[model samples]
Target chain A: MKKDLNITPLNTLSLVDKVEMRITQYIKDNNLSVGDTIPKELQFAEALGVSRTVIREALSRLRTIGIIDSKKHKGMVLSHPDFIQNFEKVIDTNLLEDETLKDIFELRLILEMGMVDVLFARKTKEDLKELEEIVDRMETNNSESTIFKLENEVAFHGKLYEMSGNKTLQRFQNLLLPVFQYVHEHKLPDAEPYKYSKKFTTHRELLNYLKEDDIKAFKKGLSNHLEPHLDRILEKSKS
Target chain B: MKKDLNITPLNTLSLVDKVEMRITQYIKDNNLSVGDTIPKELQFAEALGVSRTVIREALSRLRTIGIIDSKKHKGMVLSHPDFIQNFEKVIDTNLLEDETLKDIFELRLILEMGMVDVLFARKTKEDLKELEEIVDRMETNNSESTIFKLENEVAFHGKLYEMSGNKTLQRFQNLLLPVFQYVHEHKLPDAEPYKYSKKFTTHRELLNYLKEDDIKAFKKGLSNHLEPHLDRILEKSKS
Candidate 1:
């Protein structure tokens, strides 16, 4: 109770707003199971002494993020999985601008660099097998065109991210996919794809290291994979 | 047009919904000056053959991020000096969860680490003076409570971020403030404050290095400042 003295109270909410926060907090506090119906909107709103419209807007935003689902007859239910699904739409609709793209691109690299330990710690044989197949496809593709290699490149490393078992990190990587594609498509030709290819061979080496669970080598491999991407962007900036 | 064909489109916006894209393109194409008003909403919407509502929605999203500002009488103008303000609200709302917080925290470190290069590139006597004052205060108030010290810690680093003179990076550092606060608030008790004080001394050393524009030492100092924070987080995780 004494500690509570140091904590400021949250801002006051309207009666309708109170009902909304109550429900959202209820879900979080109770760890509400997905697909379970929340209280009936009318019943819930009335119980909180708020109008239905106020409850509707809050629920609408939650539903917009896939945190809940609503049906005319069935009412509101919690169904939110990953919050990134909501963030993805916000970014995709041109809300995210050029600078945000660049910042996010840097964000992706930082995540990748930090992910090495996690990737090696949790990597599975099945994960390595998938990565090998992706690398094989990358080598066989003759065209210098980035478009062809970009998706495979994302997949190979994406699997590595999944190996981290950090769902949020994996989803964050995928969320930055558009920016990555934009960066790849507009990339300068000075950094040879040949150079990038050799670097990606490190991913295979990384897989080997992961099999042994070598944290040092795995970090080095992940860092090396990101180096060219960072270098290419920086180099493009100068040119 | 042929170049456009070479690039695969990654979005699903209808032409009407693509008004934001068109607006951005128009700004880049014409090299429109900042603070320039956009074409009349109705005219632009009609030319693009989209309803005013669609155009308005696109513009509103841009406005929310400080990319553009609208006046009831003056119409919409390109006014954004930075894009981070929008993200601040989202960050404050606790939209980013645990792992996203870690990713963001790493991002702050990357910026702090990368900043040595930029700092020397753009250092000034005034910046050095201000940073020293912050460090001096940290030393003078060795008995400062954790809450007060933590608040000053961000302020000091945030000042460093501002000194880098990169608007994009500064905004990001600010946007990540909530995540940084979250990490710092929950860390181990006894050793952290001491190690954190070492970071302040490193910050002073970084300023000395910056005064000489010695990037190598500045980089070393930057890394030193960040090491304790990272280690503190890492150590807490192990326990």
Candidate 2:
């Protein structure tokens, strides 16, 4: 069944874990793709010099993660991994470490800033209209306040993410939604000078930058919008 | 034993699935945080009117994903969720859909673009020196070529991600390395005009932009550097 790689299991990882890794490596090394038939468990066991039970356990882990499935007659087959799909369950807020939550929050901001060009290239009349309408709705409610409501902010920015047409980014945005909300919930006080600098970019202001098709201004606008959080993240790093 | 939430099991989802959702809901409603003690299985079973077997299965799923753990006499306690840690195993390219892979590649570029300010803020003498050395190493080998070697590219970009000082971004760059490698290996014939306007930004050119600390030009440089892949992602979306 096998005559190549040595199967001396290491002490650091469980045998099952070691087998799972080896199997993935085998698939990659062999250039197998989705729908490719995986060899039988017995073959794997014999090749790796491990028991069939260990092979089964490793296969079970892969199966649980949507990497492989048992075919009706063809035995196990590789399947497409829905890695982003797991974000729903993986993003349990109560369990994330503070630094991880902070890191994710930074990631969300980076994504927002990073997508500026994509949004410009892909924005439709309808897309801009939707974003403008969301901003308009927010402007109506704000008699004098600078910040928009969370729902309105979500609507405007969600539309922008939708405009980028990246499904992964859309789902990733959903995943980071909690981290941003969590940070806002436990928000640190903004630096007085930063706030007094009067550089806050409002919803409509950002929309105008988008409507004008200005990548630099839009990026700058987005940064200004996220300045408080950005400053907080940078401040924590320095300390 | 009685509970507020209605627990009639749904036809669509398994009983275990339903129980998992309800347990998470209970945790949120009760303001639970990390290390909080989880209620006993019997108590949950009685409260939700589900069998202890169903509760156990649901808890096992939670345990595997590391949302909760059993502590001495303290029973099950909440744990920090490591959503980012799973990216390594979850990012198996052998099983990812092409579209998903493309979207992820797009995300990596976006993260690179998005982390500009953070990179600028965090870049140190050591970081810049390392990046410069990588460029120098690449330049010496390039007798005459527009593109740098793949290893050199990885070193340069990996260093940039590190400069952002984002733990999550660093791991994410690792997750995306295969996607980029795969795309380059199976690269599409790039458009004709794109090959010529003379806009391909080289790695050292990007490093020089960074050294200058011109955020605007650096973003433009980064965008030029990624224009090919970005164009490909957008072109596919249109069709």
Candidate 3:
């Protein structure tokens, strides 16, 4: 065998990045929990063998993300990270690329399709009734409008996510649903008319499949329901 | 309708929060993008009728999130906010509750199961061969091991996600996969010896499903493959 010379690439992480990893490590190593106090900056710097300035920058980033609670006597304390709030805070839609937005929008479609089992397992009679009502409104309000009534579209899909009963999935669904709306309003405009324009599945059809508990048919119908989006995104990418 | 009283909740957003929203809105309304300079602090203050201090705090928050490139000429310019970097930076594992962790862990399951179509559609022959090699390693590395070879488990699942060809989903998969590992190592231990011990679908079986191009079977198999994680999470929640 030839000599094994698998040289790795040089470390690309900045000092702050490495220091931040070390500090998060210290917390995990000590099994720290929310409201727990971490060591002062000097102690952390000394422990991690980094400069005080680097530790300070790392700590500051943590505080900015609401990871550190400075309000506890204005000292360093671990706190519950409000991710939903933090995600909302940092999300500047204009700064994101169209590809990033479409990827996120596609994530919603994937999640919706992935969640049919959860939906069927956990749905209640009232859930079905509400879904039907939303679809009824979608049909009533300008059914000839080529696409959809925005509010009803959200309600129909949001209701399905709610029925999934996975709190994590719901949180992600809430965060990502707006990306879909944004894509529909902005990037997906002026598309060639829907490819499956003849046989596109509506919200009501999806609800009926759910009501029958026919998961396979429901899944196929969802793929159809969301086909227009995929078609538009694919066409745009090809162009 | 006796005395229509459909009042909404009071506004809970603080001045800084409102100003941040306004600035983001201004960016969208003006179609400002990367490298574009935002209005100076005083200009924003005058336009929004907010104090310079409020504008300062809002801008500071934006800087912390990397939304505003403060270093470009030492003034504010729109920047591509690096979400993955920011997410990794802010994540403090010790502070997250088991419930939150489980929620995120469940997200991986949903995403993977949802991505069967992508994997099937996009997986190349080389992708399959590499997957087989990884599974072979797992097989050789003490196949009797009840849980998994941690590195191999990550490799197998990560490969599947890579095959999906969704950049957003892959980023999310990368971020959330570690959470899965964390849960597996931390919270999900001491699990009652695995519920599907008798009939669990291993990664090998999932590959076979893909090889046969049976999408529905592969989807069902992925659910079974991930069921152990869910079983444990549900069991803990119930108890």
Kindly list the per-residue Cα lDDT of model 1 for residues A1-239, writing each as its tens digit: 67669664566344534664687677656756656778876876777777787676556545434456665677776653343543554444433456556656655665676555445545678987787788778778847587777777777778877776666657767877876776556533446576665536355676677777677666556656667766665554445
Q: Rank by DockQ, descending?
A: 2, 3, 1
Q: Score the docking of each candidate (DockQ).
A: 0.09, 0.54, 0.50
Most DockQ-accurate candidate? 2
Candidate 3 Cα misplacement greater than 4 A, ranges: A1-22, A39-58, A72-74, A142-148, A185-198, A232-239, B1-19, B41-57, B72-74, B143-148, B185-198, B234-239
Q: Write candidate 3's Cα lDDT for A108-150 as tens digits.
A: 8788877776677678889888889888888789655645576
Model 2 per-residue lDDT tens digits across residues B1-239? 45566685467476877898899888888988888998999999999999998898787667656688778889999997667655667676456777777778788888998899999989988888899999999988877454557678788889999999998889888878987778655644455584658857898888888888887788888888888777777776777
lDDT string, candidate 3, B113-162, tens digits: 77775567677888888889998998899665655687788899899988
Report the error of model 2 at residue A96, Å: 0.9
lDDT of 3: 0.76
Which of candidates 2 and 3 is the stronger one according to TM-score?
Answer: 2
Docking quality tier of model 2: medium
Scoring the B chain of model 2 against the true B chain gives a TM-score of: 0.85
How much lDDT does each candidate structure score?
0.63, 0.81, 0.76
Compute the lDDT for candidate 2.
0.81
Candidate 3 chain B worst ten-residue window by lDDT = B85-94
Angstrom error of the Cα, residue A178, model 1: value is 1.7
- Model 2 clash pairs are A95-B80, A95-B81
User: Least lDDT summed over 10 consecutive residues: which range in candidate 3 chain A?
Assistant: A1-10
Better TM-score candidate (1, 2):
2
User: Fnat of the models, one by one?
Assistant: 0.05, 0.72, 0.58
